[model samples]
Target: MTRLFNDPTAFADELIDGFVAAHPGHVRPVRGGVVRATRCTSDTVALVIGGGSGHYPAFGGLVGPGIAHGAAMGNLFASPSTQQIVSVARAASNGGGILLSYGNYAGDVLNFDAAEAQLNAEGIPTRTVRVTDDIASAPASEKHRRRGIAGDLTVFKVAGAAAEAGYVLDEVVRVAELANERTRSFGVAFTGCTLPGASEPLFTVPEGRMALGLGIHGEPGIGETDIPSADGLAQLFVEELLAELPEGVASPKGRRVALVLNGLGSVKYEELYVVYGCIARRLQEAGVTIVEPEVGEFCTSFDMAGVSLTLFWLDTELELFWRAGADTPGFRKGLVSPRPRVSAESGVQKKPSSEAVMVPASEESRAAAPRIVAAVDAIAAVIDAHVEELGRIDAVAGDGDHGIGMQRGATAARAAAHAAVEAGAGAGSVLLRAADAWSDRAGGTSGALWGVMLRALGTRIGDEDAPDAHAIAEGAADALAGIRSYGKAEVGDKTMVDAIVPFVETLVARVIDGEQLGDAWDAAAAAATAAAAATADLLPRVGRARPHAEKSLGTPDAGAHSFGLIATAVAATLTRKDFAR
Candidate 1:
């Protein structure tokens, strides 16, 4: 368990600050995360890797000359905000394009994809390669959907080496995709990890038991079993990976494989070495040749008592990149020459924008700003009331951060809305400000979705006029479209879309049928509530919950639950006498 921390919320920031202070030669502080202190060759592709921060050396530690050029580090167990990824990418970009790589988690995918689109829109070429190497997460037929584990290193190394070799963006992406395909990983945990301020572990195993197929985010394993001996565990890992060879590889025998016997936090290096002894023997007996085996913590879950084994089948091309010399804060190989450092004053911080975007509004629209603020406040209060329960529900199948992320987003939105109202902003401007604050503070899939939803609604409810029932219905429809456009989740995917779609459809229908705004909203909120509750019967087809879909069989999605709760809360504000007019 984590024992030292001033505040759990500030832990990630403080950790990054200390890391930069300690490794000034390797990494420098950037607005979103840390970038390589060493200069990169102009016109060489830049590799930017990132994810939630708990995985130590995985992201920030890998930023240097022969690895990632920059890393977009996020809060503990949450994906980096889109802005963070963009900033890091921008700082790392030279004349060449940017290549984004990371584990294939839902939040990471959503945020990274958003940043990729934005970079492209700004005329900076960008590409992404999601590492999917955890064989336990999905079936062979659906290998593309597997979660990345320790195998993230294999992909990142190949991509980074390709970039350092001065390969163009497309070639670098090809090498990354090939590396992802060749890598396979499996893991088991003796115990779950605890967050800094949490009293208990995120999940736990019974004494003398081990959890199989565990995720790095403290998600409970898919199954449990009696603890196995070191040799037994190594055999289990080797057999599982050997069962499914890469498409071109017929067998592990005679293949040169790069192996990583990684300790997941609390597991000691000596323990890994003991396990690797068995692994080495097994591979030699099977006529497999091991090349440059790594035995230590690579990607970790804070203090999880677990280990994972990754096998990267190496071809001639991959072997060259795999053996390439590299230097970084965490991992290093061979000799690396020092490069010039970026000036701290010029490259360290990104100045905040002082320019404000003020949209003109009519007197009637401006008068409705207080109601928008009240609506956001109501959302915050309702989320606060049910936050714990929502987290518990999410913990059943997903990482338990949904409640906290939503709470943070709602609280920030409320503050931003109130501030905008005080500044004589209208309903649209208040909602737009709230959207920005929500996305900036929350920093996850839920945060990005909420940002899109609010911004879409605000665009439809422009500040030039008092929004009527028709405009409100249109705004709801636009919100739905925005969510679908950004998140790509369908109505039956067991996400917030399940509730949002129903709410939007019902609201639009009721308003078209001549119902008042308040009446339509009340009806829509009821529909959302029912839809959220009904998610218990539907299997999750997207997000982090998808891997543990069975575990969530009897529980509603946390995002859906929060959406329903906020819709109901906002209905009250809509029905108020002063706002109803």
Candidate 2:
């Protein structure tokens, strides 16, 4: 449980500020995250690594010489926004191409892939290699879908070292992919972690029991069993990893592997050492040679009492890179030669201005702008009221941050809409600005999808005139199209798409039948509400919940629930005197 915090929402930002102040020699603050304080050769590829903020040392702390050159840190348990990733990558780039790597969670994949595409379009070459090392998350045939865990270090280290050694971006990507292919991890938790300001843990194991196949994002484990002895746990880890060797490894015997016995927060280092002792003996007896075994917290949940074991089967090239020197805030190996500090004027780049050139609006459109602002405000209010419940629902099978993420996005959207309205922007412009702010501030799968939805609708409802029922319905249809295209989730996938699809279809049908805007919206909102409730009977087929699909059987997806709530609130806003047809 995180006890000390002024505001839970501000924890990630405050910690980054303090972290930069404490490690000035290792890292410098940038707009989205941190970059190495030291200078690098112009030809050296920049390795940009990151994910959510809770995993200390994983992201920001690894920004230095032979680790990540920069880290695009995001909000607690949320992926960094695409804008943040680009900002950090630009700051870290030194003429050489950039390599982006991170855990293979859904949010991280979406944002990082977007950033990679954006950077390439901007003429800054960039590529990505998602780390998929948690064997428990997926079957061997579907290894590409596995979640990254402690094995993130092995991939990051190899890629960072390759970049530091002046490998080209393509070469860096190759070795990183190889490292990811060879790595495997498994974990178990005695208890779940509680996020800041939360009264209870996200998920809990019964007394005298432990959860198996735990995720680092406070997601509940896949299964539960009686707590095992230290030696018993060690044997369990070794056997699980040994059962499925990487391709080309005929057997575990005679293999030289880099082992990481990672403590997931509240688990003590001494406890890890106790387990590692037995693990080491077991491996030695099996004729396996362990190299550079690390025993401590690498990636962690906030305060989860758990441990994970990672086996990085090292080929000769990987072994050399694995032993390479690194000088980062959280990790160091051998000795790195001193490098000059980056010039004060260099590194961090100015953020692009959010203000767009305002197109003149008709009197009717200007008059309708206030209603749009009100709708955004209503969204914020609804999310704020239901945040706790949303988090609880999400904790059933996913990280319990959906509520916080939606609150951040809606609050930011509300503020941005107000600012746009004050600047004399019309309805479309206000929504466009709000869309950008929501995505930039929220920084996750939900955030990205919301941005897509809002932008699509805003574009369709141009500033030339006040939108009628037909136009609003068309815009909503466009939003639905954009969301489906961007998120790649369908109606039966148990995502927000389930609710969104029905809402858009109903709204379009009602408007086509000549219903007024308010009446049509009310009907659509009701459809969405029913669809959201119906999601409880359907298992999640995508995103973080897929690994623990059974646990989510009785709980509706938080995204779908929140979307339903927002649609209902927006219907109320449309029925107000200012927005009435």
> Number of the top candidate by TM-score?
2
Local distance difference test values of all predictions, in order = 0.89, 0.91
How many Å off is the CA of 410 in candidate 2?
0.7
**RMSD in order of candidates:** 1.7, 1.3
lDDT of 2 by residue, 37-97 (tens): 9999997899999999999988898899898999999998999999899999999998889
What lDDT score goes with residue 347 in model 2?
55
Clashes of each: 0, 0
Check candidate 2 and list the clashing pairs. Answer: none
* Candidate 2, position 491, lDDT: 89
| Model 2 deviation from the true structure expressed as Cα RMSD, one decimal place | 1.3
Would you estimate the TM-scores of all the predictions? 0.96, 0.98
